[model samples]
Target: MDRTRFFVRVAAVYALIGAFMGSHMAGGGGLELSAIHAHILVVGWLSMFAFAVYYKLFNIPKNSKLSVIHVWSSFIGVFGLTVGMWLYYTRPIEGMQTFNTIFFIVGGTILLIAFVVFAIMAFVHGKFISEE
Candidate 1:
């Protein structure tokens, strides 16, 4: 239920995956998934971790409805975007490129909405703490 912790943990997982992919590529595993790997690290690891830091510093309540929504939506967005892109580029299903395009777009849109919601929450609950 700790939203900040949840986001951070998710980011950690993404970090591990990204590192693994980087290693694989360095080992000459081809550059086929380079874009997917980059997005996974940037959007999944960095972005989620940044969100965690924001929530922590902003003192957003873990039990807030907005927190729950942000957590789920962000996770879904990251997963959808990464997986969809991978599938699209890989063409594992032969005729699913259109589906993958839609999937990634929807995912990106969901992520955008989540960020907007987070911005609203931040502005509504944010207060400047003066260091004395």
Candidate 2:
């Protein structure tokens, strides 16, 4: 499913969001969103871009179910984690602390699982390959 392209595109979106947040903060926006901005840049942009490069340079089997899981979970985890963080920190609405916390934790857990799966894939199929 063109995982490399997919990951890179998603990562680009995260990069823009993170950049905007940084610019906002520089322009006198409070530091309230600083942590969220950092996480989005790191986990969302950097990690995803790295993963995309991995897919581009490695010989992970196209049919591997593990790759699918890792890719999707990475996307979901980033989205959930970033949105969850913003919600929890901003408290845009009332009485949603528990929801926000749960959402953040679940996203982190999913990202962890994706990392574990990536490690497993590296062990199982991270062979070098010629350009396709």
TM-score of every model versus the real structure: 0.88, 0.94
lDDT of 2 by residue, 1-132 (tens): 999999999999999999999999989858879999999999999999999999988877888999999999999988989998898889888999999989889988888899999888877774554455
Identify the candidate with maximal lDDT.
2
Q: What residue runs in model 1 are displaced by over 4 Å at the alpha carbon?
A: 128-132
Clash totals, every prediction: 0, 0
Candidate 1, residues 1-132, lDDT tens digits: the string is 777889999999999999999999889959888999999999999999998888767666656787788888899989888888887788888777889889878888888878888787776656531222
lDDT of 2 at 4: 93
Candidate 1 residue pairs in clash (backbone atoms < 3 Å)? none
Q: What is the lDDT of candidate 1?
A: 0.84
Assess each prediction's global lDDT (C-alpha) against the native. 0.84, 0.91
**RMSD of each predicted structure:** 2.0, 2.0
lDDT of model 1, residue 24: 96
Worst 10 residues of 1 by lDDT: 123-132
